[model samples]
Target: MKDGGINFISFSVGRYGVLKTFSEQDMESLLAAYLKEHPDALERMHFVMLHPFRDDDDEMSRSAREIHHVAKRMKFFQDYVARNPYDSTILINNPTPRSKLYLDFVHYVAALLGPIGSYEIFK
Candidate 1:
C-alpha cells in the first residue's frame, strides 16, 4: 500500500460475531509496526465495525452475556484507536447492508478520497 501511495486503510473487526480472535496487545503491536514503517498512514486508518451479531442459539446462551461480549469488543476497538499516534476514524456499521459487500464500499471510499480516488475490482 505504501508503495502504491495509498494512505488510507479500512478494516472491519468481526464480520460474523464479536469473538476474540486476537488479543488487543497483539493487534496493537502489529499495527504499531506497520505504522512505524509508514508513519504517514496513521491518520488515514479507519476501523470499521461491521455486522455485529450474537449467536444466541449456540455460542452465547444468555442475552446478557451476548450484550456484554459485544460491548467488550467495542471497547477493544475504542482503546485500539485511542492508542494510535494519529487520530483515526471509527465507522460503526451495525447490521451491515448487503450493498456494502458489493459497490457501496468502493463508492464510500471514492467519496472520501474525492475525484482523485478510484478502485477496480480484480477477478
Candidate 2:
C-alpha cells in the first residue's frame, strides 16, 4: 500500500544458482507479466533486486564490476521513474548466512543502507 508517496515492493529471488541478466527492458517485461497474472502487483509495483555476494579475494577484485552493475540498475530504475514518477525505495538483503560468526554481513549491509541509530548490539 502507498502512503505519503512512498511505495514498497517486496520480492524474493530464490537460491536456484542461475544468474539472470537484469536490464531495463527485462524489468519492464517482468512487471508487465506479473501484473497480468496478479493484478494486485500493479498497486505496489516498485522493484527490488536481490542477489548473493560471496566473500572471497575475487569478490574484492570485482568491486569495479559490481559498481558498474549497480550503476546500470540505478539508471534503469531512474529512467522508469522518469516515465512514471512515483516515490519508491529499494531494500536489498543478502539472505545468506556467513560461515563464521565473525563475518557479520548483516552489519555491513545495514551500514551501507545508513544509520541504524541506537539499536542494541548483542553478542
Candidate 3:
C-alpha cells in the first residue's frame, strides 16, 4: 500500500492497558513498522506511565500494581528507551485526580496520540 498523497498511521507509546495482552513479538512488529514508516518518529515517539494513579486495582482500572507489567516483561520497551533520540518528559499525574484537571490532561494526551474524529481508548 502506498501513501497515495495521504498521511496515515502514527504511534506514541503509552500505558499498555489492553496492549498488555499483546505478545512481545507482536509489539516488535508494530514498533518495527512504525519506525520503518516514520524514520523521524523517535523525535515524536513517547512512552507515558502513571506512577501512583493505577486505578486498575479492585478492578478500578486494572490495579496500578501491574501498571508496568508489560513493559517490564518486554525487552523492546528497554530498547526504545535506550534509543530515544528526542527530548520527551514523563507526565506526573496526581495520584488523586481532580475531575476538570484530569479531564484536561486526558484530552491533552489524546491529542498528542493523534486520534481521528473519535477514538476508543481501551476495551
Candidate 4:
C-alpha cells in the first residue's frame, strides 16, 4: 500500500500492537546478522553503495547513485519514517517543502543526466 508519495517497507509492531520504527541499532543488528550468515557482506555492501559511477548506464552505477540520494535524504527522511515507519499518510510534522525542493533538485539532476525511476521530461 503506497502512502504519501514514497514506497515503504512493511512496519514491524511491538507489544500492544504499536508499530516499531527502524532504528540505528536495529539496522546494525540486521547487518550483523546478515554478516553472520554471509561473512563477505561488508564487501558486497561496499560494492553496491560506494562503487564508482560508470559512464555507461548500468544497474551497478545506478544502484550506487540511488544509495547516495537515499542516504542524503535520510537526514530528513529518517525522521519522517520514524514517525510511523510504514505509515505514508500526511504527518502532523510534515517536511513537504524540503521534500518538494529535493524533488525539484532530482528533476534538475535528471535533466542534466537522464531520466530515473520512470520520470519523463515535460518539455
Please report the candidate that would top TM-score against the real structure.
Answer: 4
Whose lDDT is greatest here?
4
Instruction: Tell me the TM-score of model 4.
Output: 0.28
lDDT of each: 0.33, 0.32, 0.35, 0.40
What is the alpha-carbon RMSD of candidate 4 to the true structure?
16.3
User: Relative to the unseen true structure, what is the C-alpha lDDT of residue 123 in candidate 2, on a scale of 0 to 100?
Assistant: 17
The per-residue C-alpha lDDT of model 3 at residue 83 equals 40
lDDT of 4 by residue, 1-123 (tens): 248978565554432122223333443343344445556534443443344464334653443344334444444345544553433486665444334323333333234223233323232
- The 10-residue segment of model 3 with minimum total lDDT is 94-103
Worst-scoring 10-residue span by lDDT in model 4: 14-23
TM-score of every candidate relative to the true structure: 0.23, 0.22, 0.24, 0.28
lDDT of candidate 3 over 1-123, digit per residue (tens): 016756443333454322222333544444454445545432322222322354433442321222233344445544544443223354463222122222333333344444343433321
lDDT of 3: 0.35
Poorest 10 consecutive residues of model 1 by lDDT?
43-52
Model 2, CA-based lDDT: 0.32
CA RMSD per model (angstroms): 17.1, 17.5, 15.5, 16.3
Worst 10 residues of 2 by lDDT: 96-105
- Candidate 1 matches the true fold with a TM-score of 0.23
Question: Model 1: runs farther than 4 Å from truth?
Answer: 1-19, 46-123
